[model samples]
Target: MRWRVAFPGICVLLLIAVILTSQGERHVSLSDGVVAYFKRQQPIFAEKTVQLRRHIEQLQPGDSTSLLAARQALRECRISYKSIAFFLEYFFASEAYVFNAPAKYEIEEPYIEYEEPVGLQQIEALLYDPQVWQHRPELAAQATVLVQTAQDLHALLYQFSATSAQVTESIQQELIRIMTLYITGYDAPLLKSGIAEAAAAMKAIDTMLTPYQDLDKKDSIKYYLQQGIHMLSTQPDFDSFDRLSFLVNNALPLQRLLLNSNHDLFSATALKKDVFPHKDITGDTALGRRLFFEKALSGNATRSCATCHQPERYFTDGLMRNRSLTGNEVLPRHTPGLLYAAYQYSQFWDGRVQSLEEQVKAVMHSPQEMNANDDTVLHRLHNMPNYRGISLLQVQASLAAYLRTLAPFNSLFDHYMAGNKQALTDEQREGGNIFMGKGQCATCHFAPLFNGLIPPRYNRTEFEVLGIPAVDDLTHPLPDMDSGRLAFFPIGFYKGTFKTPTVRNTAVTAPYMHNGAFRNMEQVIDFYNKGGGNGIGLSVPNQTLSAVPLQLTPKEKKALIAFMEALTDRDPIAH
Candidate 1:
């Protein structure tokens, strides 16, 4: 009886002690830490913007000292922006666009809303102009706008609130952005401050991860961050950096670690709003497989989806451009491989449609393609025993479900990344090095997906003006007549722009480019090597691809092809 009484007294004492200890050392939640981090970064960014504005105001015609100071100040502002970029971009995307958007007018399609380009990139372009003094008024005006935007962001931070889950998601996305955008110098093309900015971003991530007590691989994460930051800081050169090695060694591992742990927490939420949410995907895929090959779905009851995207040829019809339903003339564009098409933010070479379902509707309704009306498609489905009860939307959902399953990451390169060292030959590895480094292919064709879908968020697909010629004549290249994305958007900036397709399965998929200008991979490499059509003296003013020659030797070109060949899936063709 005495021992039991003493035990109760001891429990009470321990509870009191626990309360005292908890009160003495307040536990900072991950949400609190993230909010704190943003708060801390806000003033720093604002100060940098102010300094940048001051430098811009002090500029004089042919004043090198003032010019140098302004440039340095701009670099500092960029570094500060990078530290908070992940959070700003993920949480406040519309507002953040004013911080570092591309220096080109962008139109939000479907909505057709116009957004004038502003931010750091605009200032950088003006500052780095050959005749900078001539653009002083524009420069000063942009700087003032930038300063105001920074102040706006500072005010916005007061209302910023992120859960632990959101913070973790932001960090994971930042890892992807670092790999796809930052290291490649996507935005900082002129300034070339990408490496330094990447380092700053990594350091911010290190700080952000501090409050997560459940992070089991914290040491490994810290090591990767340290190593990556060191690499970026020490070897700041853009062209010669061993980007492939960095990706394979540090960034990829770190990305996988965080993402794998957070997969269950955020996977469903990460999916695009355009995707049709399905419960029984396996059932849908099996049903859709039959409908995919049904000729009755076409208006003429002749060509099917499989007729153009045949399974034997990795979903391509082995044609530069497939014959139309009439079989009299060729289609407008090449039949893009359906293997990884579902992963992109949009469908078609021009990316007019946002979802696979929408793409299905467009293709079926098109006069040249399938040319099937809703009534015809419904009537066809009504006769089919399995699809009788399904609505047209249900049919589209089933097809999209099947499309999503095509991405099987079992390629030789995927295996190599998965720790099978012998999966890739040394020559292929060298090719990869060139592709990521001097070749600069990875800048447009990001890894894993190797498509135009911009990573971290994967919410946008990029369009590039490559200046692909009408015919394979490098000597006297004639620009393709295809207006590309400009046909729909009708913007000068979008003229000649086409979505960057996946380079995966390039070994088999021949007659590349939207217009099918290249007959083989060798021809494709030669075209890019000569610096696209612009380098070969085509009048391509809006060419996104650099006109400067890649200068790849013959041996390097072969290796590059080998690397691309390794992207072929190891398993049987999914289509």
Candidate 2:
């Protein structure tokens, strides 16, 4: 009798366990898949995705924070419906496989909960593999059916919100394509005969993205397409339609940050192939730009190369005049700024030098500038404690290497021309047209880089002689005024010729002209409006400035100024 009673109690205990298991298994399954996929797809989201998925398992409908975090992580990464579907596909595939979830979730967290019985059932089925492996050959097939069905539902459900609404159409296209490609290969019954339709759409979609996918068009569309791809994340900026448009057309993202930050940040942001591009002058060019500012390596120990080519005020000293180490007011053509100098064919106001390396060593040896001999510089750098780390000769070569990387790529005009329609104000666009056409600025500032002409064959620089009176006495030209390139090469063609500086960073590096004769953009345009240097009523020699006055209205003059500002790389820095 005691044995019989013990048997009934054992049966009762087993029944209790079953009821508990049946109730909780759904929660366990939901938590597992949700957390697993998040970790797999977005390694960044592993911790939070797991935590939230666990909370989702136990909570009553609307009773947890996980759902909110799910919405948020999705929001932050700008993950879209396609990304979500892609996540779910790989996430649930772990059920038949041993994919240990890397993310640890604590399901006990407090939250407003929501529960779906169907979602719970799918999660449990994926978690527990019964002996169906031996008895039912169709069980594996059922797994495929269950997972695909769940993904299709997710794709349709994602459209209810505004953030994913934009790419919802694309998400559908992608999902259908996935189903078409691999779902039919499953050892299962057809859920529906939509396979043929899905296959047809996949081909069509491939053909459709073809035009937009051309490598030639990549730069133009990258900014916009990234928006769509980013929209795949949860925390996308969908509220601001204007930003949505801008983000879609321009993908500055981490690249802009990396460019502006310190070296560690640059490396961390993109340790691999993500770089600032060849135009920024990587490697040899980067080395050259670095040596530009280094002072101790220079001769006399007092001057750095930047003493002439300053980075502040957009790579030029803001001063109207500069003094030499010899205490002579040579004025040296007002020290030309080196903004985007890499884009220019020539190096300086006189174009005496051909390459930046030659220019660096020339200044080192010049009696007027650094006044240090190149050989002396080489000797001094050879022993410096810090520089010994780098070959002294390498540092010499490095400065030239670094100078080539000094091109000013970040400017408003670059943004405007890069297909961001809203980058320039309407007035600025009109001004650009005027400058290029009727304003005659484009006659001198040509295409590709908008300053100096670059031929396909030779990379030599050209110089021009523009006659303008020296500062202070506009009536009489300064005695012993420099004749520019002519004095250097002693060639008549080189007479009064100065290598044209790239007008890219012009908005910031002012006082204007090679001599910095004009103080501001307006004054410069006004000088031009009066018809070059002569039209301004200033008597000058070798006057190559347009002799006839431009006769522009004040509005037109303002437009010209705005356009010059727009020429700035990236965004302009106010002084």
Best by TM-score: 1
**Candidates' C-alpha lDDT:** 0.74, 0.43
Candidate 2 residue-wise lDDT, 1-575, digit = tens:
00000000010000011101233544354334333433343443233334334433433334336334433332222222223333333323332111111111111111312222122222222222232123122323332333344334333223232222223233232432232221221111111112222232233333323333433543433332343344322222211112212222332331232123322111212221111112222234455554666676555577776776666566677877777766656557687765545444346676555455566667777777777765666566567664554554465456655654455455666665445778888677667655644455644554335565421111223344455556634445353256776676564434455665567667778887777777887766765666655555655444544455566778777877887787776532221
State candidate 1's TM-score: 0.81
**Residue lDDT tens for model 1, 345-430:** 66788878767877876888888998988897788778878778777777676777777777666678877776677889989988
* TM-score for each candidate, following the candidate numbering: 0.81, 0.48
Off by over 4 Å in 2: 1-290, 326-328, 389-393, 454-461, 472-480, 536-543, 571-575
Lowest-scoring 10 consecutive residues by lDDT in candidate 1?
1-10
Error of 2 at 61 (Å): 97
lDDT of 1 at 313: 83
